[model samples]
Target: MEQHTVVLYGKPGCGPCVAVKAALERAGIEYVYVDVTTSPEGLEHVRELGYQHTPVIETSDDHWTDFRPDKLAALAKGLGS
Candidate 1:
């Protein structure tokens, strides 16, 4: 099965972001994380997505505001559990 690409935009010390990543890792899913807080392109990147918040998890096809267990699951195998 082909895995979807996950681009997680988070700040330096976001608990929710950490939780999301942890869950994904526990599931053995692959993902790329981006810290928008310290990046100069943060505003531009988020603006393009029409979202103005940290911890915006982006899959290849969609964006999840929470990226919690359920949200990550949706992007997991078969859109998650």
Candidate 2:
């Protein structure tokens, strides 16, 4: 199966971001990390998503903010096959 493209929007030292990244890595899910702290476009994207926090996870069909273990697991499992 084709690998899912996961985009993780976060900052450099966000704990939830770290946790999310770690979870994705553990699940063997490849992802693109977007550091909103470093790029103006990244920040703009987050704002467009109507979020004011870091650690936003977005796939081609879905997006969310904060840490959600169940959602993360589902994304990993869905794409891992």
Candidate 3:
């Protein structure tokens, strides 16, 4: 995979957020974890993206909310190119 950035916005005690983090780690995908509850910028970013949920994954080409294994799989596949 070429150079890329993936940001995961989440808060503590969020189940889906934990799942998303695990999935990404298992896929060997590097990501930045931003605690929305602690970071004002992270909170604003998610709000700007129109998401009212945790585990909001943001990449250069795409962004989505919740623990989407399908989307995560797609992202892993795309990284091969």
Model 3 C-alpha lDDT per residue in residues 1-81, reported as the tens digit of each score: 125788999999999999999999999888999999999999999999999989899988889998898999998888862
Clash count in backbone of candidate 1: 2
Model 3 residue 15 distance off true place after TM-score fit, in angstroms: 0.2
Q: Report lDDT (CA) for all predictions.
A: 0.73, 0.89, 0.91
Off by over 4 Å in 2: 1-3
TM-score of 1: 0.78
Model with the higher lDDT, candidate 2 or 3 = 3
Greater lDDT among 1 and 2 belongs to: 2
Best prediction by TM-score: 3
Clash pairs, candidate 1, are: 73-80, 74-79
User: For model 3, which pairs clash?
Assistant: none
Across 2-46, the per-residue lDDT of candidate 1 in tens digits comes to 347777788877788888888878877777778786676754787
Off-target runs (Cα >4 Å) in candidate 1 are 1-3, 79-81
Q: lDDT value for candidate 2?
A: 0.89
Ranking by TM-score: 3, 2, 1
